[model samples]
Target: MHTSHAHTLEAARYAALAREDHAAGELRPLPNYALSAISACCRAQMAADVPDTTADLIAVLDSYKSPEELLREAEQKARSEQEYEEQQRAATDMDAPNRAKRYRDVGTATQVIPQLGWSRQMVQAVEYADDGRLWLDSNGTARLINRAGVPGRVVASSRIRLLRQAGYLRSENDSEAHLLVTPEARRALYLADLHPEGIHRDDRAAHAARLKVALTRRRGKQNARNEAARLPRMDVWAMRHADDLPATLTQQREVIEEQRRTEEEKATEKVCTDSIEEFAGRIADHLDDGWALNFEQNPYYLDVRYLYLVHTDGRKLRVKGENCGRDEQGAALPAEKLKVWAILPDTDRPIRSDE
Candidate 1:
């Protein structure tokens, strides 16, 4: 048989064997046999052409790899490509302008004297000089007077060049070739002053008076209205003594607080004393000398106290009372009414009243 026909028959036999092996569960070795059969067929085809050789076919067969290995290599190649793309994206992001940093750089540039190692005083001098002109020397170089008002050094050529480039200075060729200070340069030479326009009339006296009234209102002072009537006099005194405003306000607040506290304490004392006296008078009218009145202040109620009226037989009645004239339920009680809540030493439950 011809070599080409023999190769085809051998390939067909191997392919059939590979299929049989796969059916018999020899799956791992099947691909190797199948690839060998394919390689043989390819070589047979190549041999049919005279100039063509089996070298290409042999190389393809020699370079065969398992499916798992080939899949791993493909995944690695994809990961490499993805990583390279990410690196390029990150570099592009880094090259974008940072607005915050650019703003800071602009502020720094605006504050400092640009291009020349001159101090702020020198810049100010140039701004306030008689002519404010930068004259050019015969060599086409700009020159400026020294700090002592003597024509000494040539203006830094680089500084003049940079100023021109930055639009802070322009060359005016009228009458003489001299450098003209642009509006931007004039603005840069501006000296910021607290009293830029002129000194005005002082309003500290009025300010202090307003501050005092504001503080009094904030503290909820009872005499704030009465004190406002004296604001004019207070303003005059505050201006004369200037530094005493805070101290005076503080003293007034302390005095008001002290008076309020003293009034509250006295009111509370009168309420408690009068309630006991009135209850004692009522007891004197109804009961004999053997009856006694015992009482203690209630801890929970701010303006309330507890009273125990002991009878001759030792039966005690408990009374609750408020100095601010209200009951435990916050209902308004008569100023003369002593609230009787419970009676003790009962045969059954103690008699109780909500009033």
Candidate 2:
């Protein structure tokens, strides 16, 4: 063997041993494995001809963390987050009195407008505001009445204040009441028949960049929600067709298949429970009405007796495997093949399906 190759191989061996020792070191209370890992690491570092394996090993040793350590860090992070949220909630709660006081000095309304009518004044005011819901107040300031009794604040006075604040409207009207759509708003909002005027309208290329980005973010969230609503149906469909599953499914089939089986078992258990209840109920009702139990030995199967009840009124409760008599040609009818899935109370009584 070549000398460099021998050195590389020895270094690789020491590196492997170091990793093993490091793992063991974390587990034990004493520092015995830590010393062993350090010794192995030193040997690996000294004998290494090139940097590759040795560098990788050093990186692994420096960065690798145990499952417990990772879990503890996660728990600590979660606790800190919870504490921060609680503090925020507490601060909000404490400030509630002051918050209420802020709104207390607000004035009461003298009269309620039965409904806002689409008169010429209201129409012109809405046009001026560039907002449909807005109407001129007693002072001629454009306002939106959300609450019936409470007075609404000005959305536009000499300018469309609220829309400008929302970035959907801007004023190139400059010292005038009329407002203009922002370039971002022009791209995002579908304003038609309103003022064609806008800030940066001359720059035809700057089409609503900011509003487009905001809309994209909103669409991203909505898309996430859409996938959230859709993806569960895949698991449901997979379980529904579990018996006919193909090998192409990437989800762990062992766990999914086991869950499917468990669900089937539960369904089977419920059926069994229902059958037992039906059986006991029928037997109780029959015995109460003077029906007698006839345990007759089977013809084909040795030592097996069919259990059934007979009534003097020509009504008979037949066991599933009971002989309903031989076929027309007198060949023994296959009694064993009769109605295996049928439960107890195979009655002459009328039911909804019968009706």
Candidate 3:
């Protein structure tokens, strides 16, 4: 009935068509076509005196200017949404895959240190630097949540040493210090410890603002002192050997022994593999030694044999005259001629739980 309502309905109709056309894979919307269609439909309704329908049609057309206009708007909105989602995913990845919790206080943070002997409050959040130094988030503010925290002092040192020796932590950053832990170290710390109490150290709040070097960074200075303690007392041999040949012989012997051990392992592996193949082959061929076996030709021989060998390490070998090829004597076969199949040496052996 009202002109404004009729215009609005027509505009809405055009927008609906434009969206549908976009979904139907239009290269670009023909805005003029959409607008004309809506206008014609509105006029038709008006001529019929269906004012309500006319108003609706007008509204639909007015909602969007043209098909081209609607396509551009939708594309922009979609792009913005996609960009936002990508940024969110990137942020999530930086926070240790699926873990989001931050360790800011010593009490809360110590739960992350593996095998650390220091009190919870002394170790702060483990941090990495551009230069190789394990910075203990000691008495410093956490950037993640902006809270103060402290790392265990002594335990941090010991743990860093262990990590370095374990070859998990590396001196990649190469600052004056020996090693730098990546942020993923936090996840490693989480795997090491999960504390029930929070990390806030009430007593150390005053010292919480200070940044700390991991105990590993101070190890060089401590090792200097250890060198003095390690000084060995020596006795000069008055009756020395005529030459250094004896010492050289001892070093050569060590190398020879190492090579021998390596060769032995290879030989053992070969023996085990050979045993498995021999046992498997005998079982696949239905012939028990000396026995006369009668059987229809196997239609699925390979499939049946594969199943028989499944988990062979657990079962004991039992050779019987089960349809093996008939022998020259035409008598039932005995187990002995079957070359008593050896079980895969180490595999067939029971595993010790302690091992």
Candidate 4:
């Protein structure tokens, strides 16, 4: 009849009742407040049942204001049991959806076999054997490899050379190719293979579509501008007496100022023009009122200047043009070209141009 033992039994009873409510499909967890009251009641009830001295048993029951309060407290304990079970049901149901998206080839070793003897190191086990020949294991099961194979001599040499040219591989040996996949490459390959459709293939297709649209729009604008610039002048009278028209100082001054302004504007436009134009259309498409445009004047060249544009609350774009110089660390930055930027509230800026 110790108070601590009474408390332990009371808490255990609540736990057992909660489990029963879970079996009955009730949806919540037992709260601590109700359990404390249940413990106090158990202590009082046990004191009476133990056939202790009449004064001690009466004193234990008298601790409560009335029998009604004790009964009401017990009813709250039952409600706590109901609530505890409800919470457990909710958590179990929530995990079920995520489990389906995860593709785990567990337990059965037969389903997954290590890929071997591939001609290329980049070939992962996820890719099915090509050319109707099982280049992987001699066992001939569709080798679903969770990893990439080692690069052979041809892949080490020629394939590495090809990869460097395509900007996929870089090594100390300019001529000698190094055929090894880094841990980052392995992870990328694994993630790409995990999807229903290959990630690289989907990305490549989307990139190609974007490139096609960009090229088309660029060429269309260029063609239109060229056509306008190439049109014949309609001045037959000026051609007959070209030398007679004396130049006025005002007109000459006006022409000079116009030329200077055009040169400055062109210089400013160079800094961020290409990078901005390429990605600006995407930003403009998504926002209203649009981004801001700015330019930087190069100290070395009077006519040469960098241009930049910043969207009020958008991306932070960086540009690197042909005129920019590398730092001591061999890092390149935008200088003569336009470096367009979009302002974002957060620390992580949108760098769509580079990555």
Choose the strongest candidate by TM-score: 1
lDDT of 4 at 223: 60
Tens-digit lDDT track of model 1 for 261-324 = 8765754553354544554445445444666666544556445555666777767665443243
**On residues 1-355, what C-alpha lDDT tens digit does candidate 4 reach at each position?**
4765665566567767767767787735533333444555556556646532335534564564477877887899999977875674465332322333222311111121111111223343212222111122332212233335432212123323332343333333333332234333333334333432322233234334334444556667556444322211213321222232233345557889999888777766544334445555544444435555444577778644443455666554433332333333434444333343443323345434333
User: What TM-score would every model get versus the actual structure?
Assistant: 0.20, 0.17, 0.19, 0.18
Candidate 1: Cα lDDT at 187: 38
Which 10 successive residues of model 4 have the least lDDT summed?
108-117
Candidate 2 steric clashes:
2
Query: What C-alpha lDDT, on a 0 to 100 scale, does residue 183 get in candidate 4?
Result: 35
Clash totals for all candidate models: 0, 2, 47, 23
**Candidate closer to the true structure by TM-score (higher is better), 1 or 2:** 1
RMSD from true fold, candidate 3: 24.5
Question: Which residue runs does candidate 4 get wrong by more than 4 Å?
Answer: 1-162, 165-167, 199-210, 213-355
Error of 1 at 74 (Å): 57
lDDT measured at residue 86 in model 2 versus the true structure, 0 to 100: 64
Model 2 lDDT, full chain set: 0.40
Pull out the clashing pairs in model 2.
183-208, 184-208
List, residue by residue over 1-355, the lDDT tens digit for candidate 2.
Answer: 2555555465466556656766777445223333444445555445554343345544564456678876897899999988876674465442333434322311100010101111223223334435434454555455654457333666534333333443544444344233444443332222111212222221121123223433456667556444322211111221232232222122345669888777655533322223333443445443536566554544554324455566667666655633332344534334333322222344554211111
Q: After superposition, how far is residue 120 of candidate 3 from its true place, in Å?
A: 7.5
Error of 4 at 76 (Å): 18
Cα-based RMSD of the predictions, in order? 31.1, 22.3, 24.5, 31.8
Q: Is candidate 1 or candidate 4 better by TM-score?
A: 1
